[model samples]
Target: MLSSLTPIVCGIASLGLDHVKLLGNTIEQIAWQKAGIFKHNVPAIT
Candidate 1:
């Protein structure tokens, strides 16, 4: 699952309650989850 995505640049197309089921509760939680895509020392563009 994108294991080579070292310098992950997730230019999120959009965000909404559509994935509420998968994201669990709270938007902050969802953001935190998505943010896990980042690398330990690498930088994220967006």
Candidate 2:
């Protein structure tokens, strides 16, 4: 998941690299995966 909670646990900004393998070689694919973290009515940063 691409939750802000991830960075909170790691103490570092998320660069979306961890899903590199899972996302294959497409920016669209990565974005689709990251979008899963967006919660309805909750604000997201970057």
Whole-model Cα lDDT of every candidate shown, in order: 0.63, 0.59
- Candidate 2 ranges with C-alpha deviation above 4 Å: 1-18
Q: lDDT: which candidate is best?
A: 1
Task: Give each prediction's root-mean-square deviation over alpha carbons.
Answer: 4.6, 7.6
Consecutive 10-residue window with the lowest summed lDDT within model 1: 5-14
C-alpha lDDT of residue 46 in model 2: 70
Clashing pairs in 1: none
Error of 2 at 44 (Å): 0.8
Q: lDDT of candidate 1?
A: 0.63
In model 2, pairs of residues that clash are none
For each candidate in turn, the TM-score is: 0.54, 0.52
lDDT of 2 by residue, 1-46 (tens): 6665643321123546566788645766777766776666556677
Q: Clash number for model 1?
A: 0
**Cα TM-score of candidate 1:** 0.54
